[model samples]
Target: MIQGDTYYFAVHLSKYYPFSKRVDRNYYKVEISNKSEPSYKFYTIKELSENNKYIEAVSIPPKKEGYFLEREEKHRNEY
Candidate 1:
């Protein structure tokens, strides 16, 4: 799994700021990037707001790769 370098994201509801009224929540998908040398980029799967919330990087264990191969073999016999 590319040496387990895959990135996962976690989202949370943001606290209300003093100036902005908490009428309704607006959601947007933001594209973030490290605009420098050795750059990287990623997009948010969930909608985000400008002021309210932020994204965090979370790690999850990768599943067994061998399971995929076994599933594929079973499907072939059904045809």
Candidate 2:
């Protein structure tokens, strides 16, 4: 979250009803505000698409069970 730095975030959704819900039309907006300066700015997103200039989707395999825990457990045993 450094100033003027580009950051990318990835979100994964499970095969659940709420996550897989289809939208007829979607509206996107972004709000920019500085709490230290007490100012606010907002912009309406015209379009949000996959592999667009602003956003791109990348496919990644889902993690299996104990993926994180196994690594932590191994390190803990060493200590």
Candidate 3:
């Protein structure tokens, strides 16, 4: 939660679209900083091939904080 902290998150498409076999999970790298007005920003790093046909999905819960908390809560609820 502190500024200048970077967090990594994975978006699993399987949970949202169980029936869809084409959707692949996406990974997002986020950094916490005060450079912007929101105090945070999200960056999409190219992990997979550019030609890969995958739908990027992020299931972060609604919150006043950044996606970091939402990602943490998602894992907590799963177990």
Candidate 4:
């Protein structure tokens, strides 16, 4: 993942209690970081009745034009 970039991942949980098993999928946004060895931070995006104004304040802006597109193309070509 690119540093400071955010990505969505589907999380699945498995349970085995009372001889029962179930799977659930949840989406979470993961922000990439390099400040720590872990290299990433995760946050859950909950649905709200109105827009989340806080997101704009904390969101990371693109460094330049075509920043995300260039990264996508580069990653595609690498594979």
Q: lDDT score of model 2? A: 0.34
Best by TM-score: 4
Q: What is the number of residue pairs that collide in model 2? A: 0
Clashes of each: 0, 0, 0, 0
What's each prediction's TM-score? 0.20, 0.19, 0.19, 0.27
- Measured over all alpha carbons after superposition, the RMSD of each candidate to the real structure, in angstroms, is 13.9, 13.8, 12.9, 16.4
lDDT of 4 by residue, 1-79 (tens): 4435544443332322221123434422332222322223233344211225435433646657498788888899675
Task: Give lDDT tens digits, candidate 2, residues 1-79.
Answer: 2355433222333332221222233422233222222122221232222225334222444366488678788798685
Instruction: Report every candidate's CA lDDT.
Output: 0.36, 0.34, 0.37, 0.38
Winner on lDDT (1 vs 2): 1
Q: Give the local distance difference test score of model 3.
A: 0.37
Ranked by TM-score, the better of candidates 3 and 4 is 4
Instruction: Give the alpha carbon lDDT tens digit for every residue of 23-54 in model 3.
Output: 34542333322332222332234422121332
Location of the lowest summed lDDT over 10 successive residues in candidate 4: 12-21
lDDT of 1: 0.36
Q: For model 2, what is the error of residue 11's alpha carbon versus the real structure, in angstroms, after optimal superposition?
A: 3.5
Clashing pairs in 2: none
The count of residue-pair clashes in candidate 1 stands at 0
